[model samples]
Target chain A: MAGSDCLAANDWICGEYVRSRSQELTDATLQHLWITGASVAIGLLLAFPLALVARRWRPAAGPVLGFTTVLYTVPSLAMYSLLLPVFGVSAAVVVTGLVLYSLTILVRNILAGLEAVPEDAREAARGMGYGPLRLLFGVELPLALPAVMAGLRIATVSAVSLTTVGAIVGYGGLGNLIYEGMNSLFKAQVLTASAICVVLAIAADLLLLGVQRLLTPWTRGRTNARAARRIRIRARKAAV
Target chain B: MGAVSGAWTWLATGAHWAGGDGVWHRLGEHLYLTVVCLAISCAIALPLGLLLGHLGRGGALAINISNAGRAVPTFAVLVLLVLSPLGRYGQWPTIIALVLFAIPPLLTNAYVGMREVDRDVVESARGMGMTGGQLLARVELPLAFPLIMTGVRTAAVQVVATATLAALPGGGGLGRLITAGFNRYDTAQVVAGALLVAVLALLVEGAFVALSRLTDPLRHRRRARRQSVNSRGLPKRWVTE
Candidate 1:
């Protein structure tokens, strides 16, 4: 214990940190990605259908949104602690916690996205004899893609950050590095982990932004210009 | 079923209900951490956000910086600060880290609120011979109040939750119950502690909602505001509520 503690002191260099912590870093990063990715995928699957139900039945919207909102407000630490007994310290518990957090954003964006779809497009599709399922899949979903993608970007980045909190549950990704580093007073390990997490988050966010742009061509440059114009126009018009 | 019953038993223990390490002490510590950090964060973020919104020049920068700030994990920041020279200063590291985490939402919401104020309304106020101060105080600030309150509510709720991390830094907070539970493998204690945190967070959220309602008469006005529906049944506005 004395020997390990001594080794941690004043050791903020790159080489020493890599030599001792490489395996820990690799394991953490992978676990973190797996936990986050799996949770988000699950969340999307659940949230999309729930969003549809809410949209279809106006009464369902209040309860669904309220439930998810309550879930969202729960502290992540408390949430992990709550699940501690039920799922133990496994990745399953951590993923479930992250999934609950993701639902609110995903559902809100999906509903907003679906609702944002143009009436003309829907009418035109119906005029062309498209069925309800066909219209939802082919016309509505595609138009709502941009907003949904934006929500995904937020959820993914947030999950990445929150996964670190999972360290308490023993499923922390780069978070484990941080926890270990702080407890041991190892400056190098802590610095490296933080740097990595930041870089990873930024890279993920930029990549998603690029993906959103690629997926939504019609919304390019035009949406912001249109929004501004609409706001300006609204100033002149009285409330309907 | 037994898990909840166990949690109840843990809470019912007289020993657990009193003493230096009691739930009340932990709750006080939790609230202190949340309130102090939130106050500091608001002091910095609110003024800066409101200023930027008034100028409408550097708001994009504020938003981008905050986004980048949010991208960095709060745990990582807390850990780094705890190991640095700052950690020796008794809760400074934890407070600073929490402040950083709280800033993004505060800054973004305030700026967004301010910017979202109708430009024509500002112009009309100006035409009515209102000074810069009067225009801001009388027109812009009032209009931006709802969004700003939304930001405060969001920041407060998040801070209440994240403040539990204060325990990991060898600081005092309600998280001690969970940490101690994990160490002892006491599931009941952990559940109770978690319940306390969740309840505290919800309480804070509820308080904020009431605050928003009381303060932002805009809520009523906005409700009366007619929402335009497009050809598709969807709202023309981005958000409904």
Candidate 2:
């Protein structure tokens, strides 16, 4: 009787338990936005200046970026630990680490984008005697903006996922709730965190998609085709 | 270099890295966990990637799903699954998360590789009365192998690096040393852990470069010739003979 009761209890524990909870998820979503937003802003501030300097003196990029890649591969928590001694376990340390993480992705892509602009286009601008700064800002930078934006999209998404690690240092986000739920063995809290994070990710991605569309009108054609195909596939599945 | 020097010095010192609570042992465990998770993820990803590539359908869906996978935080998934009925903690959950992390690159690559194969070659193969399976196996796969290999290589590096995230749930990887260092306020331990992760990523990248070369011999031969010409003014064999 005892063994059977234990088995029954285990079975009950294994089943799905979905319930209503809106406020907690909303609060988490907002926190995620702020954390990731601040981190990306910090990253762009650091990386753009470095990229401009590297473009002026080409060899500098190799070593500067090599160092950044090493920093990039360091685990998020590990970077935080290395920072904690001097910086302490505050929002500053978390932001610093997150910002550094974005550098490797953004800087390299920025450099690549600048280099990828056709030589002819640059020569034509030079023929007009627009000067170095004008040529770079007017010709190269605008062309490179799409690639830079793509890199920013990737960095933003990466920041979203990684900012969760900040919760370990008492920086609250969706991840904090998830961690708390796990430690306390609260299944409801865990589910809420997981669902909130997923929803937030989707919302952020869609927002970025909208931004991409607004910036690059040509992207709309491709996106519309893909969306139509997806609708068709989903409708077919539903009908079946 | 100014920023890195302090961390590097702490890791180099013997007292900090060695002991009963040794940073080195933990580093080894961390690397071991990362390597195992990457291997498992690659094994799963490579086949599914190839299958999706072969079908030539669902490329957008695969990539979107992968982007979704990347966006969904690893720790969040770990908590939800590990705390639920799955309650299956440790390396398995870590591996699952790592696999989820790595799948996007592999799938995207395979799809691109297959799609990029010369249309004329495929048409000729079909016109020769070759069956679809035979055409794919004999012509398409070999031609697509180089591009597919590029994806696999990328996935390998990414998986190894991301595997550190596994340390959170007591999955026992290098990140554990980092966490321990944080708790103890020991910069040395943290530095050693961070260095090991960086070294591991570079090592994996180097190995994959060699693997890609071995798998695609023509590219390797061309690279060798280019290097020889750049270094010695001419091919040594041609010069000597």
- What are the lDDT scores of the predictions, listed in order? 0.85, 0.72
Ten contiguous residues minimizing lDDT sum, candidate 1 chain A: A1-10
Place model 2 in a CAPRI quality band.
Answer: acceptable
Write model 1 residue lDDT over A1-240, tens digit each, in one string.
544553556665566557676787888888888998999999999999999999999999999999999999998889898887788779888999999999999999999999999999999999999999999999999899988998998898989998998989778888888888788787887888878787878888899999888887878778889999999889868565
TM-score of each: 0.90, 0.76
DockQ of each: 0.73, 0.43
- Ten-residue segment with the worst summed lDDT in candidate 1 chain B? B232-241
lDDT of 2 by residue, A1-116 (tens): 54344334433222232223456667766787788889888888888889888888988978989888868766676666656665766777778888999999989888888989
Task: List the pairs of residues colliding in candidate 2.
Answer: B30-B173, B30-B174
lDDT of 2: 0.72
Q: Which stretches of candidate 1 lie over 4 Å from their true place?
A: A1-9, A221-240, B217-241
Which candidate should be chosen as best, given TM-score against the real structure?
A: 1
